[model samples]
Target chain A: MTRITRDQLLARLRQEIPETTPWEVADWLRDGKEITLIDIREHEEWVQGHVPGARHVSRGFLELQIEMVQPDREAPIVLYCAGGVRSLLAAHNLQELGYTNVYSMAGGFSAWINAGFEFEEPRFLTPAQRERYARHLIMPDIGEAGQIKLLDSKVLLIGAGGLGSPAALYLAAAGVGTLGIVDFDRVDRTNLQRQILHSESEIGELKVESAIRRLHDLNSDIEIKGHPVALSSENALDILREYDIVLNGSDNFPTRYLVNDACHMLGIPLVDASIFMFEGQVTVYQPANPAKGIEGGPCYRCLYPDPPPPGEVPSCAEAGVFGVLPGIIGAIQAVEAIKLIVGIGEPLVGRLLMYDALDQSFRTLNVQRDPNCPLCGDNPTVTELIDYEQFCGLPPRS
Target chain B: MSTIYIPTPLRRLTNKQSRVQVEAATVREALQALDEAFPGIGERLLDANGEVKRFINVFVNDDNIHTLQGLDTPLNPNDKISIVPAMAGGTVKA
Candidate 1:
């Protein structure tokens, strides 16, 4: 019943970020402010062409590897993605983690390249890289500052198939600080149709290995960290705690819930994207308070009180999704994550936007909080983590 | 006297009947009458606390009952009731 207008809400939220200007960020980047520019995009985009000197650590891996990227808590950091939503989420998360002086590039690379600044040609590739990335260097939205955002970013990907493919490719070509992959699953024959991260020779090989090789072949300047382990409860929180933000591409509900809960508990924002067939959805859940706004605002539990019953809802395993679905959804997820990291644009919160590719219909629903919600209710009952599988009634992993 | 429509999944609890007539001053009373005539239907329709489960969609006439007044939404004689699960499309691929 307490509804604040958009302007009023934003005004309240503005206190979370330290006010800075683009010229100031430019000075920090040039003046050796020890600034870290993060490109929160996937690897594939990085390969196509990226900002020179950017790291490739993904938002998912950023939480775990944030210290590695910026050991100095107060180091100046700038973040950017394709359209600039994810970086904003990232900047908010960084602020919550007690890191000051984090900035998000306004309008992201889309605006950077549109500014018509010079871009670094895709490096460490065949003579064809010039032709492949010829269109990138000529654009203004991905000019030098956007490229710097890419060069200084490090993105780690979870799940190199489907959604991760485009995300990885885009981030790689964008020139991130470092690129990391955490996936033990092998590239299967079925993956070729959508997993642009691996090729025919990569089938049956570890996904991280395949993704790293392709990403390196695309851009050698970015570092690639390959963790060949399935993210589980024992390791999920520990792994996610270090990174700045998390982008979830896993198809299973358990992983999704685990990531959500872990992010909230650790006070990290998660850029979530899901695709069902041709339909896709994307949102930024700032598990931390909205900077200057309400504390414990709305977590995933606020949207979904309880996990759906097993076998009651279909997964990509049971439900075949369209090949292009992840391409659309993952790219958007990358975009949002970068926006979050960089501090630009309004992040999607307290709303569920569902896309129906069949009819090309996008529906936005106002997700209200359940006053009796166990996690975020007026009087919460869930204070600690319970085995999500048990709560969801799934068989415990042996 | 309003007609109560049973969804396909719950029809087994109602002996495969598609519709039935019930008398009540409101939706809640009519649901209580249906539970009296049939058995175990209310358990699935209503949670343990008697509130409608979050996933089930109940409509009075053509309007969602939640938009009206939830379980307290009034019902009149000759009102039509339909119950449907929020079943989305798609089958698992793997």
Candidate 2:
């Protein structure tokens, strides 16, 4: 008997999949019965053109500010991005999260443009605006509302290096309402490759401040809040609650648990992602649903009942991460956050996605809730926040 | 007699022995037997009222005892039991 290669098996699986098209959605929209068309592309993309009268919320702000921005949760909603990849993904995300009538413009705005629709001319920028937004406007996915979402979003980044870099940059360019950074360390030369939030000139400066300076320069509309103090048992939950979404980009376990617990208790959906060398994992943690049986969603404690003994696992400093690993995973975290905020897509609440950069392979492992999890168990024992450092058996900084 | 395998963190109480032999018909009995030999090791394994800590996981060979009867998980003679602390990493930055 011959063994089938992985590619052959994947191709067979792809063949079995059904097609998703926009004409069905276009027809649905044209009928004008009871649906809202969402132009998921950037504001510049929307300004230069969009489906007329379509809501102009960008993907970045949509997820973080959904409850505030989209008051009618029951409204039939459809989303479209540049080429439809992001929009299709966003539509599937919305469907997964209990949105009944979500749809994606199958071909997205590119297709919309191809259909010879009229568009608002791209706006001219002042010299300062040009200097600040030169890189962002060039990218179709992150033009105007995308940049505005960056300005409007309040994202809490647990780490300033690696994964936090791209997440912050994209959020800034997308115009997230506010960007909150939590990092106690100073910029080290080693962080430049992946921690794009910091610059070589800013070495030895606080990571949060460095990120703030660069982000402010990038987009003055964005509010950058810096928390230079380390996240600890005393302040983790409170700090996390202030932000619309918490991005876990830290390189340690204790902080991950703290962030998870805070998000779970606060009912603020968490956009979680992690990187280890060449491999990375991304997931959304929604505390509202326990039936999904996802550990992290219930709380980090649900997944990791206890922290590995100190030194049992090597740190990123010791294990050496691929320079680009955080970039990929961090960007996905931003996507999940935006999806959650806008209430547009299925927000990875129950699924844990893993990426192996070496083979360019992605896999997901089934995560089950610990029936006896202290945080979200049938008879939960942990009711309030405990000192994360104490929970992890770490000493407080002097 | 069955052997109990202890993970890295709790091994200091076991004299750094990965595996130690103890005689007991049930998991609770085996833990008691092990506790008699090593005084403080049981505290880490069992809480104040002798309930297992939520973080410490016990396995009879490959199957987790938590799915069975937890500390009361029955163990036949010659069975292998292993205790491991869950891998908890990532959270907080200093």
**Best by the DockQ measure:** 2
TM-score (C-alpha) between model 1 and the true structure: 0.56
Per-residue accuracy of model 2 over A1-398 as CA lDDT, tens digit each: 87998667545433432223556555665687666777777776776766665777777766655555455766677777778666765665565555665666656777767866644554344466556766766766665545444445577888878888899888777657688999898998988877888888999999988899988888777688999987877788778888878888877777777777777777767777877666677877777645645334445666458775565444556566789888899898888876665445567765667676766866454444666888877888777777766666667655
In terms of docking quality, model 1 is incorrect
Candidate 2 regions with alpha-carbon error over 4 angstroms:
A1-152, A289-297, B1-94
Off by over 4 Å in 1: A1-150, A290-297, A369-371, A377-379, B1-94
Give the CA lDDT, 0 to 100, for residue B10 in model 2: 60
| Every model: iRMSD | 6.3, 5.5
Q: What is the lDDT of candidate 2?
A: 0.70
